[model samples]
Target chain A: MDIIVSQLMTGLSIASILMLVALGLAVIYGVTGVINLAHGEFVMLGAYAAWALQTEFGMGLLASLVPIFIIMAAVGWLVEVLVISRLYDRLLDTILATWGIGVMAQQAVRLAAGGELRYVQMPEPLSKSVTILGATDSAYRLFILFVALALFAVTWVIYRHTNFGLKLRAITQNRAVASSYGINASRIYRLTFAYGAGLAGLAGALVSPLKSVSPEMGTNYVVDAFMVVVLGGTQSLMGTLASSGILGELSGYLAFYSNDTIAKALVLLAIVVLIRFRPQGLFTARVRT
Target chain B: MSGKTKTEIVICAAVCLAILLVPVFMNDSFLLNKYARYLVLGMLAIALSLSWGYAGILNLGQATTFGLGSYCMAMALKLKTIPIHTGPDGLPDFMVWNNVPELPWFWKPFYSTTFGVTAGIVIPLLFAALLGWFMFRGRVTGVYAAITTLAAMVVVQLVIIDQQAYTGGFNGITDLAQFDVAGFAFDAYGSASYYLVAICLTASLFLALAVTKSKAGLIVQAIRDQEDRVRFFGYDVALYKIFIFSVSGAIAGLAGMLYTIVMEFASPTFMGVPLSLSVVIWVAVGGRQSLVGAMLGALIVAGMQGALSESETFLDSWTLVMGLLFVLVVLFLPKGIAGAVETITARFERRDPAPAQQPQRTDAAGAGTHHLESLP
Candidate 1:
């Protein structure tokens, strides 16, 4: 019973992090119709940003989150204006270009930070453990779960109720019709891309303390996040949440039974098999073209 | 033949001839050895072009086949190495260290040189065929195929790393004996090895070129241009995709075995992400649609890498430079170096009236005829 409770907690924690990462990817890919392979690099850059802020200025990870998000958003904006903006509608070309950007970001970090692993300090107050459902777990893990839920709720409200999101949705449905309605599709795209990138950055910042920060860390995260978004079905926010929960629990349970490596391999194989059956993914909304 | 086809054939012939004659002019064993590795990589680029350029399937896990081939060859060679490197029972050293008392059934077949050679090509071919069957049958195209392949590669890599006893784990298979056939040996630094690589590359180029010119090849190109239309015309699109993917995998496997022979060892990194991405970069730089151009791209980019790594500062920044080049190529040189050459040649040929025989059958015309659909 203890093990089950603890496992459930760990699974939820993992699911929250996966949701955070996949959320940004879903938004970017869903709205823009561009697959940003550099999404992981954005997450990586966020982790680095957190490390720099803490090491250089003694800022706490929690306090540095907003600044890191904004900084990453600006960086994303620049990438959009410079590269992704030009390659719109060219899906394959966009993938290659983003991969190039990812490589450059990784190499640039290696050159700047010297390719060594960096660490981020957890907040002093969140260092304790808490018992939930008769299971003791890290307070920090619970904190991440809280933050993730809060962010998702915030995103849901923005997506469903905000005028900006309405314009973004209009653009997504029909760019020509949306443009005719006086919606600046390009501007919305830029902002949406930036916002999605910023969310990825926040996930990175949150995850930095749990994992060692490195230039190559983004590759793994990107792959995982992609699996989540892909499994959830692109453009489906609710599906991203559900799939992340399913995969997170699946990986957590599998890892508990076997080892981390086997668990990861199994999860990937399962996703591949699932994708083979349903290329549209597990939860695609029914709509007429 | 169209003017473009003529130009491609002439260029391919010149490149093959130049590769064969290099030993005649260059006696430096060190450079000759380096060129041999590049030529083997050139074979890998050709394989990638067949699938990505011709069939329009971007296989991001190409290194999976290459690494599998390398390991197969390495296992066989390891068995033939000096007894000192083996266990008391003559098993590979890593197996002994892991307390594996007997040679596993899988590793046993690799003991025979002929089996190793055949398995190197056949295994990857089968693996790719199985994967391609699932993918194409499921109608997975474009970016989805790329992601699935990438995920599969990572899964394979993780499994290899996890299985320390059979795979040699992270250290990989090393201390292999020289590649030998009966009494004849091909030393790494000798002309024999270089000649073998050169001959294989030339043969592969011809084979690839021949395939590109065949009836099925034309159909494959047509499928790339308009997949649904080809299906409506009663062609089995999935079957052709599977064939090209398997053929490409077989070629990559062969390249991997050659890599193990030339580099003298096989590591898990052989099937790593970086090497796989590098192969794609070479194809992109060379012009993915042209087999000969793709091969040349591999040679040039790999040669540049060798040169860059020779210096400390440049070694660190080489990937950065490559990244920028890839981005620039996508932006301004989408068709790559070969595409540029064709444009220049077409301009010169424009002066002649009716320069081409088949108007609808040119490579560029096919490429320009269709814009790929972005799947939701």
Candidate 2:
């Protein structure tokens, strides 16, 4: 019972991280109709940025997040303006181009970090454990959970209540119509792309302390996040969050009993089966563009 | 052959001759060997172009099929030294480490080279056929097909990585021997290996071209351009997709077999997602609609990598350049290097017409539109 609860918590924490990763992917896919294969690479870049700041400036974890997010967001915007802009309507080209970008990013990281997995230093507060619901858990896990939830809340609030959010939603449904209504489609695209990438960066920063930081680490999570986005339906943030949580938990529970590789394969197989049945996704929206 | 086709054949022959003479001119065995490996890689890319460039099936799991071929060859090579009943000294190393009593049932048939080769091509083709039938029959196309294949790649890689006892885990099968054909021992190293790879690559290219020029090839292109229309014409789109997919898988397998011969080892890395993605890039860069373009793309990319890896200044940033090139090509040169070349040459020829008038220009424009409409 104790093991099961502990595993469940771990799963929830991992799911939270997965949600953060998939949210950005979902948003970009929703708005631009571009599957950013390099989306995971952005997360990787953010983690590397945080690591660099921590090492060079000796800054605390919290202090590093701001710079990391800003830098990654800037990079994202540059990518949008320079590369992804031309590939907006062409889905297959965007996939191939971003895949190339991903390879380059991963290799660049390898050159900088020497292909060795680096350990991120957790703050003293985050290194300890706490009791929750009659079960002891790592505080770092709880912190990750809180941060993810907070971000989710922030994203929800931004999307529902803000003008930018309304514009984004409108553009996502139909860019041509949105443009006709005097919303600058290109500007929204650039901002949304950067914002989505920034969220991925934030996800990386949140979990850097938990996992070993490596150049190739993004490849591991990207597929799972893709699965989450696809399973949850590409347009809905709520659907992405829910699906990420469920899939992450299922994967974690399976990993507890079986090997990690098998667990991952099972998750992918489940996603394929789900996709075979429901090509429109589980929680589809009526936004036909 | 028409004069144009004859000219093309001559140019292709000259290029093949130049490639064949590289080992003769180069003193370094490594350089020659690298060229040979590139040829095999080129074969894989050609396979990709046939399916993706011509047929519009973006199979992201090309590496999976390639790995199948490599493992097939590796298994056959392993069986020659090891006894059938007593597998590699009473137990294969991995199974021994995992404490398995007997060889798995699947490993038994791999003892025969014939069976191994057949299984290698058949398995991937069957897998692709089944997958393609399920997806294509249900009318999956474009991005959905790409995602499904990508999923298959991830699943296959995970499976290969997890089945450590049979697969050698991350440390893939090694110490493979040279292939023997009907009791004739063939050296699998140095010049001999290069020749073997060349032969396989040429044969595979010929086979691919034959398929591309056949009636089925025309139908495949028709399906690519208009699937619904093809279906309306009473063509079984699913069967054609599955057939082409199987052929592509077989070609990829053949490339894998040659790859093992040239590299002298096979690892999980050979079949990773990156390589699979790289194959797509190769086809795209070469010109998706042209077989020769696919080969050129693979040759150029692999050659660049070899050169860059040997250089001190640009060793790490090669992929960055390739990535930039990818984005640039997609943005500016959608038809790729070959397409760009064809466009330039056509313009030049148009300027120097042989007594042709305005009628030819209209015909040329009509041809161009036909080509454009055929493109996916």
lDDT of each: 0.89, 0.81
Scored by Cα lDDT, where does model 1 land?
0.89
Q: What is the TM-score of chain A alone in each candidate?
A: 0.96, 0.96
Query: B179-229, model 1: which lDDT tens digit per residue?
Result: 999979999988889998888888888888888888888888988878998
In candidate 1, residue B182 scores what lDDT? 93
**Model 2 chain A weakest 10-residue run by lDDT:** A280-289
Cα error of candidate 2 at position A231, Å: 0.6
Error of 2 at A235 (Å): 1.5
Best by lDDT: 1
Give the alpha carbon lDDT tens digit for every residue of B1-376 in model 2.
Answer: 4665565556556666666666677656776678888998898898888889888988887888888888877777766656542354545566777777787888888778889778767776777778888778777777878888878778887898888888877888876666777876655546766777777776777677778777898899999888888999999998898888888888888888878777767788888887888888888888887777888899998888888887765867777788878878888887789888887887667667654667577578869886888565
Flag regions of model 1 displaced more than 4 Å: A287-289, B1-3, B351-376
Clashing pairs in 2: none
